[model samples]
Target: MSTGQVLDQVMDIDEVDLTVDTEVDVNCISKHRSKVHQHFTKIENKFQCNHCKKTFNIEKYGCTSNRLKHLNSKHPSKVEKDQTHALTQKNVILQAFQKQQKNQSEADLQRLITRFIILTDQPFVITEAQSFFELMAFGKTNAPAIPSADTIRRKIFAVYDEEKLKISQKLQSAPGKISLGADCWTAATGKSFHGILASWIDADWNFQQVGLDFDILNGNHKGKSLAASMFKVMNEYGIASKLMAITTDNASNTDTMFLELQKILSEN
Candidate 1:
């Protein structure tokens, strides 16, 4: 063949190979590109923005970093109190609502009670409910009342006591080696009392206070009554075994109690 004709034939063969290779490469690239595009589309559809009440295409907010930022920028006026103070105020409102439901009709009290509960439990304070009447009459067209701080305090204590008892029971039921810690002090009445505390490590390796009892002992530091009081708390909590340790200050009665505890453990 002539030189020009030979060069043309070589070029035709090279073009044929290039065309076949490019088609395969193009198909593989197209497949991966389609997968990447679908993955992002799915993520965009699921996420929504809590602030601005806008439904976003992504799984999380694209504009702000966190809920706090959304609240500060979008809901500025409503975010007046810090998180802790707002929670405390909500607790006060819920307590008042729970107290007022006893003597009143449910139909008459539902809105006020529900509002009080929501305000008290939420992380914001719409308004304060200081008393039963105040809580009930709140948001009424004619008049509104505010609860007293004293009443709020009393309601909080009621909840506190109930929680304390539940915690004590949970500690008693826990299975593990327990310990007793004791401290002493003189009250304002000039009477001396010993405070005994029992504790144990839970499954999560956290030390929990299982039981506590205070006893007023007549200047007699070495009295059997103190030992009895300690034993009473242990028995009430159903702690039948000798604890791993008993921690207390240097007192003759405390020493005696340890010796007695040792004897009890030995018997078991």
Candidate 2:
């Protein structure tokens, strides 16, 4: 500021006596210059209200509580608007969380439906049970929607495929060769069947065994068809080359099938 501006703003200048015996004190001029410097160097503490777009500072008449009191008294509409906006944002977050929970419940229920279908080996189109499940879940918060029979069936098949892949991976990673035991038999209904089992000693030297397949012998259980079915399971498990031995009953067809399988294995 110019000298006149500083002189006009400094209250001490008005209190000075312009007597004939004394001039302006040099210390007073220095003090006024310090005041100007302090004015420029001062750190302002101010906050702006979001909703009202108004600024307030707490430097003069107490702390920030006065600014807050003034804001509430003068701009209540702006405070209400901010409160409403905050409530809206909270509701949005709540809705997103609820939606996520609903989706998770739906996924779990679909897996449960698949288990129900496969473990029971029941037809999917049991309308009575379907309606019962729907009624049970009705008006329940975050409950899964009851799907149609076809949808449940599809989920069951998908679960089957995923489990098959896991088991195949285990077979491929088995430490030693797997032994095979096959049997052909006539069921009570006179339907022909052939069953295959895989056995092996695991890394811990524990004996492990599982049924590989149980196929209906609609056609003749000749060497070619028997070999085809067995090999299909082996190849699917990626363990065809690790076959240690095959055992079956002393039937003529069984011997033929073994001979054919031997030739196929040797050739490959």
lDDT of 1 by residue, 1-268 (tens): 3434433433322111112223233322222211122212222233333334544433233222333355566666545544454466555554444444343554334345444544577322223534555554653423323434444444445655776678667766667877888777777888878787777777787877744667787665563555656666677666656456768888777777767755664664
Give the Cα error of residue 261 in candidate 2, in Å: 1.3
- In model 1, how large is the Cα lDDT of residue 249? 83
Q: What is the C-alpha local distance difference test score of candidate 1? A: 0.52
TM-scores of all predicted structures: 0.39, 0.55
Q: Which stretches of candidate 1 lie over 4 Å from their true place?
A: 1-161, 259-268
- Point out where model 2 deviates above 4 Å: 1-104, 127-135, 138-142, 188-191
lDDT (Cα, 0-100) at 230 in candidate 2 = 76
User: How many clashing pairs per prediction, in order?
Assistant: 7, 0
